[model samples]
Target chain A: MSDAAGDPRVMLRCERLSVRRGRREVVHDVSAELRAGEIIALLGPNGAGKSTLLDALAGALPAAQGRIERRGRVAVALQSPDLARRTVLANVVLALAWWGVPRGNRAPRAREALRAIGAEHLAARPAATLSGGERRRVHLARAIAVRPDILLLDEPFAGLDAEVRASLLEDALSALRSATRATLVVVHDRAEAWALADRLLILIDGRLVATGPPRELLEQPPSLEVAHFLGFDGRLDDGLEVVLTRPAHVALDPAGPVHGRVTRAIPLEDGVRLELELEHGRLYTVAPLPAPGPGDDVRVRLEGGVRFPRFEASAPVPSTAP
Target chain B: MRLIWDELGKALPMIFHGNPQLLDVIWFTVQVAVVATAAATLIGLPIGLALALGRFRGRNLLRALANASLALPPVLVGVFLFILFSPAAPLGFLHLIWTRRVVFIAQTILALPFVVALSAAAIQALAPGLLAQARLLGAGRLQVSMLALREARIGVIAALIAALGTSLAEVAAVALLGGNIYGYDQTLASATLYEVGGGYYADAVAIGIVLIVLILILMCGLGVLQQQGNGIRMRFRSAA
Candidate 1:
């Protein structure tokens, strides 16, 4: 494992790491390994310790218990990048200066990083005056300028528009793919993680519930919690179990098992999302149909169905035996 | 009102005059203020940054000590320093009494607490996200301090200006330790006090006007610098 191609080393490896904010232990015992040339996306809902885990990996918060083994430098782009009262180019140059880059060669390197992010034109502008998306790009460029062995990004694409988001995602992916370094990203949205991640880790209440390739986790989740988090509804029919994946995975058919009338059809950029009113309230399905108006009778078929054990409800039933 | 207007008229020319005596007093005041402000800043900025950034035991006590020092009377500070550096005191052998250096030292001590308190407040008032982001950028301790200072440059300048102004207008500390010796330790404030004691009310008021003008210019310069720091533009008309 240590001598593999494109693998510098295990950049950061945690063993039962825990972190506490104030008196509350936000991160429970968590352990994971981030390898080189891999873009790992941490997925969770709000208040699920995703940011806390990212902070631990970035070394901003110390682990209260357990050990974190890091082999090389870690550069982080925080959720809110601190823009100094200086020009954007100066911000990048300051990062280079912190890394001990000589004064003579710093400008070219800073300009190169800015160009990589398509922010070279805004170099002379004051950073405080730029848009939020532009500031995020400048911060990303500053982080990438260091060329750290591990890069941690916390919600780097949160406030960016779709185009800028795609561009930044592509730049990050290219950087992660080309370098012999590891990248860890924290995102609450499943669609984004599926789009950009090589491997995915789902964190729930400070615990690592599942970790695997993006497709594997999306197809057959470890549990109903994982399935629901991936925007799916898992049900049980006697001994047989079934999992309903995302709306985009279901297709329309003339004759199918699930039949319902389209209650609402929302047109998306790529496809049309139709809300089908089946026996279980409404089920959402996505298709590349040309604007299906509401109140249309539609039949849906699950392309790749998954089966799992029945879900166990935590609450108890009231006794009515007489 | 008439006296103020007459004094102002006299003071403007006196300040612009090519006399060495007047120039010397102005130069002495500026030198003392600059030295005091620099020394205070050098000692206070790090201590302030450390108090704001570092998490340790007795941190509140250290902060309280700094805050308490802000209320110290200049005369008391002069007396304490005078005692410490007088000819019979333990450090008296250095012979630092009755000199401009003593006045500078006294003023620096007098201004230290305000600088520390204000700088620390500025750092503490910065957004917490800023510090966290700085750490994430691989900034160690020194870089973190520099980043905080850069981010709070406006407030830091404000604190510096206040310290400089206070040091310039101070009399007891300089008068007590400096002996008000002409051409040696006499500042504008001390010169005004000396002229008033000698029944030269017109000269005293004239010196007072110069001091007021100097303070006004200093304050306006600070305001402009702060606006530039905050990226605010000044309004003006063009010849076109």
Candidate 2:
């Protein structure tokens, strides 16, 4: 990925963009850039301004403050797309027709788009009769059919079972890989962002807190808040530093520094999830089946952790790490 | 009871035998109703669409006014237009009173509010964000409006049927405006009133039956249109 400084490939640029809903500002003044041929995943918790930000970027909502510049046509598949009461093929064809595609070429292009997403078999079905998963695929096909320079998808994997999500994810990735357009997808799961995005952006409470390559940001989250969002389920606070660690990074040992009493042992398909209470806070970890039960004390060693200076939990976090 | 049965027997033959006066009344009624309903639809749809989709000050006020007019009395409209087209009134120079054109104008006025209010309600019932989504997909302003109308077509068709029903069955306004001039402005509705007043029970029954049949035919056509537009259908199965 190219840096934001004077990159000619940048298809979208936002400088200090802030958006307001009614009386409250939901998206703070944040600057970001999307370059050509990169998939950027925007990760945030529920109501972290993810959808609102996408709407502002898509020009569905007006910017309360800041500047947005787009170099080419943009297409967005909203989280809950409204499908007209028509056949699936006609739905896609109408979109192309409204975009001024020639009458002779619309059906062929629509069919091709549906074929790319493995939805060609559903061409004759009424859009209203489609299943939830099928509706998502059709929405994606409509966006992909436009062949836009900038594409925005808001929670494409939302509300799907594990098996269907996996299948759809593969199809979505394959379709996205075929194009070199700049794409931004909003997601809540860290694993999904890592799998699909070349770079990840972390947003919390309407502020963009961190952004970098997925691997780089995964190893070092830069702050406690960002670490928690990245699935660091265990936290150990020494007198000098506050360390955040994922369940996979901590191991059981006799002489480990951190000691905790097991509060609950929840069984999982492959293992057990041990909920432990430490002196300062709670920690959770996965262990093999037949592991420690409730009321048992255990000691664990931290493999390495993202460390931060000691500060009160209530202290305001900066928008970005120093 | 015997007299009623005798009139009904005569009415059936009068309808089946193609009575010339009855045929003329039916044709005239259809012509005036079709013209009035078509004119009302062409004018009211855009106004209703604007009320549904446009955001501006005083829009609710206009909508409230339209809703209030849904119950406007046809006789009052007749009286109002009668004064306007009277020779001594301000619009008297047009000399439109006692003519089919006057009947058409009054019926259009009577039906306009129904079309506007019902069509607006239909468009407003669509799912939120449909318009914005279409715009994001590269639809221009006019295209987005057209899409909205198409999405709410079933409701619009119902609105049109309501307007046609109102125009076709109109009597008080047609009487007051057209003066029931034979071969000029006489309609089935006004002619029925004339026949009944003159003690011509069989002719009145025949005209009333034809009017009802005309309404049924038009409504059935529109109902079929509504059915074809529906993409979702409900099915009921017993657990036998």
TM-score of chain B of each: 0.89, 0.93
C-alpha TM-scores of all predictions: 0.82, 0.91
Candidate 2 local lDDT, A205-240, one digit each (tens): 998988899888868776778888888777666575
**Model 1, total clashes:** 0
Write the residue-wise lDDT of candidate 1 on B170-239 in tens digits. 9998999999997789989999999889877766776777788787887788788877867753221111
lDDT of 2: 0.84
Candidate 1 lDDT tens digits, A1-322: 1222233566788878888877888888888888887789999988989998888777778888877777677888888876766789888887877766778887899998888877899999988789877888898888887778888888888877788788777766655453577888898667669777889989998888889999887766777677777786423232433344556556688888777788888888888888777664356777785756788888777665444444552221211111
lDDT of 1 at A271: 82
lDDT of each: 0.77, 0.84
* Per-residue alpha-carbon lDDT of candidate 2 for residues B79-178, written as tens digits (9 for 90 to 100): 9999999999999999999987899899999989988999999999998666777788888877877877888888988999999999888889988888
lDDT of 2 at A302: 64
